[model samples]
Target: MALVFKSLRCPHCQQPIDKPLLKQHGLLQAFLKRKPFPCPHCQEQAVLPEKYETLISIGILTAVILAPLLLVWEVSFVDSKLLFGLGAALAIAGLITQKLDKA
Candidate 1:
């Protein structure tokens, strides 16, 4: 529930970068590989922190683990679907709000 809003910034320009720009530049792959990516604003290299990556990984794992457990609990179909949808939304929110650091 600590999924507060955050913005990715360019190290050189110190300007906020959009999520779409990061996706366009393959920054998500660069995060897993611990590689630097060019900032769309200033073209300076930046990298997502290991902590951020780990947090996102954990969020995704939680959603994956919770899916089958929900079914096994025999909750009403509508309730289970609602819970799963909430979980998935949280995972994606965590991903978007995590910040990137200078390379």
Candidate 2:
């Protein structure tokens, strides 16, 4: 399983808002900086869509599931290059799936 990031929306106006891809943007960065973005239409606070936390959990689970397999393969008879390449491929695929999944 991989994390699914749902696109956010303004709660009051129901306008679709772009979810931050990295921690640098959105409320996820509030710990470092709190920038208030007023809803363009309703003049209220904009919020991210629900289920983002679940997505994070899913992504973490995906990593946990993959890590041991990667480690085991590295220690086994599998070629190092093959093992590393496969691990990279799996990680990239997981990230792509999470990014591309529709809300």
Candidate 3:
């Protein structure tokens, strides 16, 4: 969905957060820790909330599980592969743009 790829905004400056920095922070770390990291735009402490992290994790898991099933259901190999790649891209975007909580 379009909403999944929406860019995360900095709470302080309202600028879009950098994707690379969020990727470096990682989905696993964001899910497990509530630690504040500096915002790339405003340099203020920002945290990825547990709820958003959990949702992203679930979305990724769902995509991973269902994409393979598409192949089993007699979908064309190329179509299924494309769907899988799209699902993965969307999942990564969700992780990169996960909403931040004020810290």
Candidate 4:
């Protein structure tokens, strides 16, 4: 579950970071943050979610996220090879999101 990606921080308030900054510069210093990013819709800190219910963390979330794809081809048709593609996509997305939260 370790991540090597980076996230962005606001230049004015050092709050809600973006994707471009991280992808461009790789890493940024926390002390350089100068702005706070408030969500225009909710007026809340644009932060990431780290909280997870134990039940969901223990596989429920996995089922929830992947259920859609499984249902798409739920019929008795495809071979076991398809699972690898789905698993890879899910793993990459999860890794990116995890790194985003920390940045």
Q: Write the per-residue lDDT of candidate 4 for residues 22-71, one digit (tens) a residue.
A: 33443223212422334322334433343322222433344444554556
Off by over 4 Å in 3: 1-7, 21-34, 66-97
For lDDT, the strongest prediction is 1
The per-residue C-alpha lDDT of model 3 at residue 37 equals 71
**lDDT for predicted candidate 1 compared with the true structure:** 0.66
Q: Model 4: residues >4 Å from true position, as ranges?
A: 1-76, 99-103
> How high is the lDDT of residue 39 in model 3?
73
lDDT of 3 by residue, 51-80 (tens): 555556665765687777887887664576
lDDT of the candidates, in the order given: 0.66, 0.45, 0.64, 0.40
Question: What local lDDT does model 3 show for residue 3?
Answer: 29
CA lDDT for candidate 3: 0.64
Quote model 4's TM-score.
0.28
- Worst lDDT 10-window in candidate 3: 25-34
lDDT of 4 at 81: 40
- Colliding residue pairs in candidate 2: 3-59
Q: Which pairs of residues collide in candidate 3?
A: none
My TM-score estimates for the predictions, one after another, are 0.46, 0.34, 0.44, 0.28
Q: Candidate 2 residues 1-103, lDDT tens each?
A: 2233354455566665443432334344431132454544455654333243344445454455555665666656545555445555655554444321121
Candidate achieving higher lDDT, 2 or 4: 2
